[model samples]
Target: MESLRELFKIGFGPSSSHTMGPQRAASKIKEQYPNASRFEVELYGSLALTGKGHLTDYIIKQTLGKQTIVRFKSDRLPYHPNGMKFYVYQDEEILDTITAYSIGGGTVEYEGSKLQQTKQIYPHKNLKEIIQYIEDNGISFYDYVLNYEDEHFKAYLFEVLDSMFTCVQNGLHHEGVIPGRLQLKRVAKSMYQQAINTRRESDRERLLVSSYAYAVSEENACGNKIVTAPTCGASGILPAVLFYCYKQLEIPRKELIKALAVAGLFGNVIKHNATISGADGGCQAEVGSACAMAAAAYGWILELNNSLIEYAAEMGLEHNLGLTCDPVGGYVQIPCIERNGFGALRAIDAASYAKQLGYLRKNKVSFDSIVNVMKETGKDLNSAYKETSLGGLAKEFGLKDGD
Candidate 1:
């Protein structure tokens, strides 16, 4: 099976499945049809329904303009009046009259009578079909689609892992100390200060302790917050693991990439077999899956057996069972940011405990079984918690009501 690097990626904020995914698909479209003078874009299903709230439209626009999605500045985003349109580049002049949509989970499609529909084995609502009309008598169908669940190639995996490490480090240092929003109760600056004070300790120990301290403060100040995983809305978890590996274990930079690779593999498996988008599977899919990935990575870096890695991964997933994607506001602000810290702490705990318990003797949990449960649970969840901004904290707190 291919590794996880291809499945999970590091990109701009707000969303992975929503913003990043669509941009990725757009790049793929360009890749398959380079040198084309004109191109059109379209969207379908869930992407159309709640794309605006998730910033899917903006992502697609940037993608089709041949801009690099990962590094593009927020102010440079392209804007279009309609959801679909075309771009014509001739004589070094760039003219875009294209139409597109931001399907939830980062999916976008181009619309037209000439469009050719391409189907995938995976069942997802946010589908994109890019059709080009060639002069040849025979018509050709091109599918610039992304499959979240399938195993990805090694080269792709490495690229993503490398990007993720860079993103996290850049976000932490250059992003200028993530502002504390989301009623998180704890403050990023405060936590950072505490982490600094504990600099005498190993990175792993300092990160673990500081995170626990922050979680304690948050619980005391406000209440429980979900982990945002790779995002600030889902932050903390990935950073915690990365910091621990870098500081405590003193893992080399090259080995860190390997660790991330292992982590990405675990995340991709959950995404493929279950869900990673909050719109589809709730917070469990997002944060829970991230925790599971971190745990597996920790185990792998520690040189544990495959069984240990599996155990850590399963523990990470199971512990976060039934989490809901209930951000107070539609923005990835609010509870989303602080939640990452909690998830990261949990991952470390799970990894350490799994090591102590002995993977050889620990009860085995089937990945397939857990995935099935996640899918069933997501189906049973209310629409309010599924990225609709209608339930959970979004509605209960009256944040962005009528928005």
Candidate 2:
């Protein structure tokens, strides 16, 4: 794992892989050819298929300006699912041609660059192995993260948490129809208002979390700034759960910071062991991972022991296994925004269930095992189901290739 920084990227959303990643790639091009007269980029596979709705082209143009030429290459690349080739020209002649892959989140890999070393922050890469180390060290999982992370990590996490809440506040205040053909009415503000007025005490926490999740997801869909708890596609889950716990359960800010650390560690584990990009692993890797992260965080907040905390995280991912990346209309709207609400609700419920069951004591399955299974299942999934928008809800809604 690189750092919690890699796991939580603060950027313009809707789609992290499609928007943030491409913007980063274009930024590198601008730096390399500062005086170039022309720039061209050909988006491939998942990028090409859903780039329009994700604002991939708009982002690139915004980064590189009007001199840029863009193309949609629908054919899948051999290197990665979300691939783009960049061409820079000093005049009419091509100066350089480079290809890059937006692996996941906001990370990008250049074809000619040396491969990124999978640096191990801790000795263990999975939850099963780390739990034993935790048992021996007399330390919590968050302590394990602290042992390896920089001393300034506390400040970094504070910033991340700050950004999360800011997005929620902004999303809650903004009310209008979201962009794109769907004209999806902004429901977060209304949802929040309803939750506030509800007399059903049992529904208060659930509704609050659901509204918060919707707020964050709606912000992302509107191209507003938000933190990618794992990725922009699933940005809403962690904040919704954590904020709910802080407000409803009255957890202290310092304790919530520890919870954030725990969640980041879990996210890093998944990103290292499998994939977090829908272009590679579908929605299972994106929102599914976010749910697990939120679950573990909430479990920590609830004062669950290590075993149950892991169990909560396990249930979060297990139930969401094989969830496909089926954002309707290629826009991270319809199912994507609604999906975050469900992810938040499930995460909170999973934590409570694990605590009640004492799942760590008798559960047969392990979080590490599920991580492996998720990767295998993602590999087995068809390309169309992995953010290409060529199948599932996209196809059912009559969205064609490159739509």
Q: Which lDDT values do the candidates have, in the order given?
A: 0.53, 0.88
Candidate 2 residues lying further than 4 Å off, grouped into runs, are 114-123, 359-361, 400-403
TM-scores of all predicted structures: 0.65, 0.95
Tens digits of per-residue lDDT for model 1 on 1-403? 2223334434455565555656666666566556655444443333443345456566666666643222211111132111333444543576433344332223334554233333334333210111112113232111112233344444554455454444444333321322223433335445565566765666636555445424322321221221223332354466457655665567876666667656765665565556666766778877787788788778877777665667777888888878877655455555555566677777777888889987447656754567668778977887567665667777787765113
What is the C-alpha lDDT profile of model 2 across 167-266, one tens digit per residue? 9889889999998887889999999999989999878767889999999999999899999889999999999988887788888777888999999999
Residue 358 Cα positional deviation in candidate 1, in Å, after optimal superposition: 3.3
Error of 1 at 173 (Å): 3.3
Best by TM-score: 2
List residue ranges in candidate 1 displaced over 4 A. 1-5, 25-50, 61-162, 174-190, 198-236, 359-361, 401-403
lDDT of 2 at 331: 93
lDDT of 1: 0.53
